[model samples]
Target: MSDDLLKRTRAVLPSWLAIYYDEPIEIERGEGRHVWTADGTRYLDFFGGILTTMTAHALPEVTKAVAEQAGKIIHSSTLYLNRPMVELAELIAGVSEIPDPKVFLTTSGTEANDAALLLASSLRRSNQVLALRNSYHGRSFSTIAITGNRSWSPTSLSPFQTYYVHGGQRYRSPFAGLSDGEFIAACVADLREVLDQSGGDVAAFIAEPIQGVGGFTHGPDGLLGAFAEVLRERGILMIADEVQTGWGRTGEHFWGWQHHGFVPDIVTFAKGVGNGLSMGGVIARAEIMDSLGANSISTFGGSPLTAAGALANLRYLLEHDLQANAARQGPVLFEGLRKVGSPIVGDVRGKGLMIGVELVRPGSTDARSADAARGGGPGEPAPEIAAAVLEATKRRGLLVGKGGLHGNVLRIAPPLTLTADEAAEGLAALVAALEECTP
Candidate 1:
């Protein structure tokens, strides 16, 4: 059944659409922490479609809201007064963390980011933008222009003059050997150098608190906080791309930017907030959000159905304290991986439910065995091994995810509603997969 569907998908879908594993399995339905394939085989879902199925699959609150709203009305455009839209905007503004914030709803993360870019550039009156190296923004033309990953960026043509900066992901950074303070200083100096060389008319510095599609990678907690200070003095706006890092996905911080101790001028979000409904938004300080008096409205941006459903999801997430659940379950899964303790696992890092284990080719420089673990050549990215492990994990009734600039990181982001038992089960499968697949 999957094979037939895959054939049909390739025949009709765009060539660039990516599928997972050796054979792509169709997810027919989902429960708390699992999904059943078209053939009725269940797999423990770890990635949650790149962290979109945030709370849980088929959450009753969200489903009920959607069904009830749809029966009354779906979309009535933005022309008339929409109570649900206004109510949701009010809720988001209260939690946005920006002082005097205003919200604009969109249909996707790409659109939210596109709006942010346009807002910043229009206010600053410059096309020069700063983005962190190894960051993945979005696939649209404008967002792709700012994305630092060459693999995900499909085109060279861009509307903005984008400059790539360091310190987004520090594991493979040039300052890998430096201490945290030194690394922050070095990255700050680099940002200054870029501004100096570019003649200093930069519009904004946009970055992800955790680079998502680039893999679940980030520098030290205070890295962005330091950068924000430097940019603030220069009158440069900061945009936090919180599409993946928002909604308390990163444990210990309600927003990923909070881990760094600073609030961004603009924050863009999608995925998870809607709990699979097509909804996204940008929140900005009113002064910046209203910079241009040019009136604009998104026809289907805050439709009644998506708004009602997303509101229910948000309420359920907060009332049930899903963020606290993520904080509790995250460490359990990480400890399990540590006990796996395979040489193929280079690093296990992330917060809350979002985690990643970078893979390296086994026997690379023998840093751990006969030779000492110091001053050895870094292991090459083992993408082939990652692919093998994905297949192995899938066969064991576990569905994790693979990513990274070099395609060597296994990204694990289960629903925030994951239980301790489910975490143990997923980790057990992951360890077995590693043991069977590691060379």
Candidate 2:
């Protein structure tokens, strides 16, 4: 059944756009942490659709809310006020630490980020913005501009971003030789330089509390606290891109920025907010959001249907204690990977469920043998070990995903509903895959 479906998909879909994997399984449905192909084969899904389905696939409450809202109204123009939209705003405010959080809803993370950039620029009356290197905001023009990835080719990048700092690569940080306090001081000094050199032209400084796409690197508490202070002193808005790290995925904290011990002027969120429904948002401190004079708006930004789905998802997450589950399971999963002791595993770091295991080339016999224990390479592994692990896991009734600037990091983000037994199973599969690809 899966083969037949795959054949049909290939025949109908554009070949150039299709990313063909070795095993072309046609996924038909999903429930909890499991996804089934048309052939009825089950695969434990640790990827969670790249952290977009936190409450798990087809959650009853979310599905019911979406169904009921569809029956009522699929969409209503934002020109008119909508009840779900209003209620969702209230829900967001309750969870947010911002005094009077004002929400600007969007259909996806990119839109939320775009809105954030616009809000920052308008609020500060400046075009210069500072961003951290190796961050992934979104694929929109403005968001991409602020994104510091070297691979990004954002069209029309203003000649004017003040200076992008590199953050969260503590092992090889730009401030590697400095003490924690000195490192914090260095980061703050750099930003102060940028702001001073640009003569306070920066409107905002955007960063991810935890660098999700950059291999789940968590920011040091003092670093973030000091950076926030610098931006605050300069009167620049701080935009925290919590698209991947927010909405209970991080476990211990509801908001990733809260982990840093400061509140952002604007926090952009998406991914898990609607449990796979198309909903994203920006929560701003009241004064920051009110800076604009009501001329800025999105047509489908706050549809009643999407808002209803968000509301239900939020309730389900809190009531079911999914955040607590993420917090609980996250440590277990990390320890399990650590015990694998695969030499190839250079780093195993993340908070909550969002995690990554970096693969680098071995240097010495000890390093090689250590990686040999887990099956990793020194430089870019000749055969793409991570890709092999992805396929091997898929073949063994599990689904996983990969990411990183070099696409070598194994991204292990599962639904908050994932059980300890399920996580153990995933870790076993990962270890087995690592062994299978041992170079």
Error of 2 at 209 (Å): 1.0
**How well does candidate 1 match the true structure in TM-score terms?**
0.97
Q: What stretches of model 2 exceed 4 Å from their correct place? A: 1-20, 154-156, 159-162, 176-179, 364-383
- Encode model 1's per-residue lDDT on 1-439: one tens digit a residue: 7888999999999999989977788899998888998889999999888888999999999999999999999999888889888989998998888999999998989999999999999999999999999998888999999999989988899999999989988667777668989998999999889988888899999999998988799988889999999899889999999999998888798899999989899999999999889999999999998997598888999899999989999989889998899999999988888778788987788888889888888767424322234655446678899999999999999998888998999999999999988998898999999999776
Q: For model 2, what is the alpha-carbon lDDT of residue 372?
A: 36
Clash count of each predicted structure: 0, 10
Please give the distance, in angstroms, between residue 3's alpha carbon in candidate 1 and its true position after superposition.
1.9
Report the C-alpha lDDT of model 2 over 244-294, residue by residue, as the tens digit.
988778888998887777888899999889777888989998888888866
lDDT of 1 at 368: 36
Residue 113 lDDT in candidate 1:
97
Candidate 1: regions farther than 4 A off? 365-377
Error of 2 at 11 (Å): 8.3
lDDT of each: 0.89, 0.78
